[model samples]
Target: MLGDRLGEITGSVTYQRVLRDDDGMKLETSFQATGTFLGVSVSDVGTYVTVLRPDGTQYSEGRGIMTTEDGRTATWTGHGLGRSDHAGAASHRGSLCYQTMPDEWARLADVLVLFEYGVGADGATTSEYWEWK
Candidate 1:
């Protein structure tokens, strides 16, 4: 079961590039966002690589770091599958695992998170996370 929503972030795609084309069309993208996570203010930055499969689906893996307003940090990695509309919009669902600095927020290390990620044609991005129960 999915639990309460843990966080949400709105950001912009900072960069994107074609990485390869031989087997499948692979691309790398990076983004930046600011939002509240685990009830604390944070800034996030991440990069992900995606491959366009023959059936028009996409597979991606990404890793990122989030820093709290006071300097504490956490790291996360995730994988997801999605499809584009061929008109510059896409949506994905994935799982995320996090590791945090051993502090008050360390409980995050024991939690499994599920996420919904979306990108608009103009490069806007939104991500929402929920705890897995």
Candidate 2:
């Protein structure tokens, strides 16, 4: 993740697949962030563990899988937390679709985009776009 000095945030992320069972797949990710935001040395840390099915459906925090009319597509109920300057907890909920790409290249492209957008520079945004060769 990378941001501006006004809130400059930059970091590297590492993800590990920890468990795969009949229930689903579990991913553990760690992020190291360091930067300046709000005139303060912004240093934060956190981790996320997501359980997703082979079809890309996630099950956690009241989110689950829902099928479309044709049954060819699956959608997930989404939820997350918001970062705040004050110490508190925030929550979010939304819906997302599951898509299957044709090849590994496509899959990799999608992952790269996600990382970039997740950590791209945006005022008040904690994440910024990342690119890899």
Candidate 3:
């Protein structure tokens, strides 16, 4: 597992479609992800799919595994949300966090990683994350 403060994920959008084009837009997207943890390469992170609505609400689900550069593996399923940020240009900001077990990681089952995303109501985007001990 990549803990909150140790690993970071990079995602490539694999699919995207407009579900609703009305004023409060709705979009569906899929992503192919990769990551890094404290100088270690974590590969084949997983596939992530999400639906985002103008109401500052987003729901996501994903299944993937992490393999350290040295070949240790950890798998997990994740789900999370984004809520309207009350003070930051109305951008919805929140986290998609989860836990997993890496074959060689001590306390493998206790890692919780969080990935955060945000889109400003003013037409901008932001991201961040942190995890538990």
Candidate 4:
């Protein structure tokens, strides 16, 4: 079994764009983050999209795949609840759970992860993640 500190992923926003619609423009952000998993460095590239509804609520969806340095890979999804600040940066609180991985990395299948996601007015983004025992 993997311990509490299964690993950490640290990356940056690779790109971000806005799509305008009737309600408002949707936000799309992509990032490349890397972390240590199972004693090896792993990398992930994923995207998060958010839409502000007419009722003043926010909906978000995210998906990403992780690849270990040696070639094993696994997929993860981020489902969250969010709201925008007065300045328009989205503040989100959510959990990220993952699918199965290869035999060598299968321990990740039972881990629990929670995170705080923040997108600043200047387009800078930061995330803090924790693994629950």
Candidate 5:
């Protein structure tokens, strides 16, 4: 994703992924943001759910998928909640691509993330990244 600060309200993001199964994939990700929207300093938690198509394209459901602390840092993590095309599968897994803004953009908020996922009987893979704006 890519965004710019409009006086106070600023946004930015960039993402990409690959398929790891034949049953399709599901990715749930969250982020912490501390920034002023419309010049009003604000802080809040945001979350999202991405349903991956067999061809690799995906869609996101906007909801609170992560949490933030009293300060300015937020941590995000998500797991497989079944697939869009199948409900009887034992499990599903995939990867996540994330980016963060600069501190000057978040004057009041910051973003942190812990991403993890699993494929079939394999265990989970976890990674971390940070962003502020």
Candidate 6:
């Protein structure tokens, strides 16, 4: 079941590159974001690779680290399947698993997070996360 909304972030894509282009196109992208999680303010940096098939469908896998104002950190990994629109926008719904440094934020280590991620045609990004209970 989906629990409470945990956080939301808005950012921009910082880097992108085409990694391959034979049978399918493989692209890599990195982003920077800032938001709040469990009432704590944080910033995030992540990189993901997406494989775009000939049919306009895509699969993505990514890992990222979130750090608090005081330097506590958590790492997460996730994957999703999505499709690119004709206008170049893409959206994905996925799940994430987190590992937190032993601290007050350790409770997140036991939580499952679900996310919705979107990229606009202009390279803007937005993400929202919820707890999966």
User: How do all models score by TM-score?
Assistant: 0.93, 0.36, 0.56, 0.69, 0.33, 0.91
Q: lDDT tens string, model 6, 14-130? A: 999998766577989899998887788889899999998777788899999998888888889989888878898899888889965537757668777999999999989999999
Each model's lDDT comes to: 0.88, 0.35, 0.54, 0.75, 0.35, 0.87
lDDT of 2 by residue, 1-133 (tens): 4222223355555433476767666655455565543333445344555565555444332222222222322222223332212232212222222243223224223232212113322212244322222
> Residue 21 error for model 3, in Å?
17
| Model 4 spans > 4 angstroms off | 1-3, 20-24, 53-57, 84-90, 110-112, 119-128, 131-133
How should the candidates be ordered by TM-score, best one leading?
1, 6, 4, 3, 2, 5
Residue 34 C-alpha lDDT in model 1: 87
Model 5 / residue 22 / CA error / Å: 11
- Return the top candidate by lDDT: 1
Candidate 2, run of 10 with poorest lDDT: 88-97
Query: Which predicted model would earn the best TM-score?
Result: 1
Supply the global lDDT for candidate 4. Answer: 0.75
Total backbone collisions, model 1: 0
lDDT of 1 at 132: 88
* Candidate 5 lDDT over residue span 27-74, tens digit each: 554433444432435443445556776664455543332212334332
- TM for candidate 5 is 0.33
Clashing pairs in 5: 1-13, 1-14, 2-13, 34-109, 47-64, 47-65, 105-133, 106-133
In terms of lDDT, model 3 sits at: 0.54
lDDT of 4 by residue, 1-133 (tens): 2226455566677888987887586878888877776567888788988887767667878998889887888888987778987897777877778886768755557766777777677666666666655
Which has the better TM-score: candidate 4, or candidate 5? 4
Q: RMSD in angstroms, all models?
A: 1.4, 15.8, 6.0, 3.8, 12.7, 1.7
